[model samples]
Target: MIVVVDSNFLQNPMLETYFNESATNKVVIIDYAAMEAFKGDTLTSVVKSTAILRRFPRQVLIAHGTKTVGRLTGTREEIAKAMINDEGTAEFREFSAHLDRYERGVRPDGVERQLLDTGRWATDHLNAAQAENANLLDVFKELTDGIFTKEEISKIRRGEQEEGWVAKGFGLVRDLASDLLSRHPDGSVKLDPKDYYNNFIFRMSLCVFVQLMDWIRVGSPSALKPARLLNDRVDAMFATYGTYFDDVLSLDKQMLRTFWETDAILRFVYAREHEK
Candidate 1:
């Protein structure tokens, strides 16, 4: 089966062995952060980095947009120059730059804290909306009659069955998130009611947002550690793409559980400590 391995699996000797033994399989390794650090202004350094990405053919699943590069290189000479520039800039990609830390078994501090904070605000805002608008559920239920039961609506209100409910309604959720979380070029997030096919990063961001909301729905204060949450959320962002793969191997238990609970029928293997 085509298996996707997250960066964490690379650190575990046993898991690495598992991966090595399955070399013939269609294995993919992805680090979204690495790709993300490039979706900005294409400076000299950015061009240099994009060139390095082309070298790793099998490992990287995505590449920088050509249109994006063209924007930075208005002249054909500049474009051609960037195409030939082969100075290694792997260190510029955020995830690749963090390889040393990963090898040392160190975690990034305070990463994705803003996302968690934003999610907390979103939850509070959603709860407030439901409270202030008493007929909200009934109105939605009437509009989506026969699609969602009244009991299901009640469970959703209590955040008791959102995971199962949302999984069952992924197309609906995708449409909603697409409308609600589209990013504007001015570095702002806005709704794109008519556009859902473009903007890969925003789509992935919505997926992560939905997954994090699920965590908040059932999470206790003690269970939501910031560092761990950041790690898991980033891992979840990476794992979202794994939904398309045949199977996914992960050393992170939370990631394995996250994929298993999603609508995506992704086979997940939880890597365990192997005997010496």
Candidate 2:
């Protein structure tokens, strides 16, 4: 039997001992990501390390993070947008123009960079997860299922009926951006209107991506209307990448498990060494 423990519970050494003394079992501890979320902490690190060592015998556990899988999935979409321009469209050119401007001695504000970095991080994790598992799609599905609900996506669509939801959603993104900016070593810088606009576009794309992932993970027939609308918009943007998209969509659970294991271990090691 395999026992999985949440990072919160795993922090207690006694709890780990209790499991260790039990019958012959294999342990898989998850969620080394929690350490990053909380920053470096000794207790979390120890728990993470202990769990990893027991990987050969009993399963140890940790919490992934506060951000739901659906949220991360949405972030993945946003990163993909930055990495892959719309197949052959005017927006593609527009996006290129923005990048050109940034490359030509145009420094983006802290918020913009933070948002971009966040998207990149999410993408890295997603790709890592996929590479680790043969069946990446199923794992993606499971992780996403835990974060988004059909009702939430429906609310987003209904929000389209009113302007407030868009404002609220944008507000949420902006607030998150602002928070990230505040933490940067350097203070925020003034941004050109065009650069700001580009950031907004990327931000919105990320929000939509996150919402759609939530829909895909938890959506039902009731969510079909909004899901269809969102899917149409995304599909219209990248018609030729259908096969690649489908391949990603079909990932399996094993990939997800491996993603968690590897991520957890790396995070655990990082936390342990850095905590002191």
Candidate 3:
């Protein structure tokens, strides 16, 4: 089996023992920075050195970062607006035009190169996911408008007990965007939100984000959302990519709850055990 474990799992040394006993298993660890450190190393080497199961051969994969997938799916304008909320569309377009300068090492002095590098990487990934998932767009276009039966919403609220229900609900979520995209003068040219927003990693991140927002609204209506807390949640959202593997092992209750609510297909090892 393949498994995805949050980095926090490394704090518990006992977990390594369980993984070591299973030689056939593959494990993946997600992080915003881990991918850079393992740049030239083999997957096995990185896994053995950094992952929970050192004795086992390195059989791991890496999802790049929190916003990487999210930024990749939408229209250029949409992505820019999401990243720079205060900026007007024309202003963002002007900012994006500097990519060539940044690439040519013409960036202003004292600017953090890492941030620029990340931007470039995200841009590249966005193009790639678009090309790869382009065929899937038509599949999403067939979805009904944002409306769902009361029973469907009830099941979605109850969380992922049924197969296809979460996917159907996601179709509704995409409808919010699709409805707008459908208004183009060329009615045949509709962009499917899932084609961009619900790509493997982005979908998981969104699920966690939506669930967290719901909690924040209910738990502390007056509280200001802190930057660090939001960043932490984004970090945890990367764990959703664990669905690509066999199972996800996350310690954060919020992340676990979000995963459950989404009815993601991946198994949640710790959550299942905790229930008993």
Best by lDDT: 3
Judging by TM-score against the true structure, name the best candidate: 3
Over the stretch 41-122, how does candidate 3's per-residue lDDT look in tens digits?
3332233334443334243444444444343445433442233222232332343344335545777764445444544564
Total clashing residue pairs per candidate? Answer: 0, 20, 2
| Poorest stretch of ten by lDDT in candidate 2 | 241-250
Q: How many Å off is the CA of 144 in candidate 2? A: 16
Candidate 1 residues 107-158, lDDT tens each?
5664334324534554454345335445433433343455545666567557
- By summed lDDT, the worst window of 10 consecutive residues in model 1 runs over 266-275
Residue 4 alpha-carbon offset, candidate 1, angstroms = 2.5
Q: Comparing candidate 1 with candidate 2, which one achieves the higher lDDT?
A: 1
lDDT score for candidate 1 against the true structure:
0.43
Question: What is the C-alpha lDDT profile of model 2 across 4-110, one tens digit per residue?
Answer: 33334434565546556765542322233222222234323333433433332322222122122112222323522333222323332343444445445564676
Q: How far is candidate 1 from the true structure (C-alpha RMSD, Å)?
A: 14.4
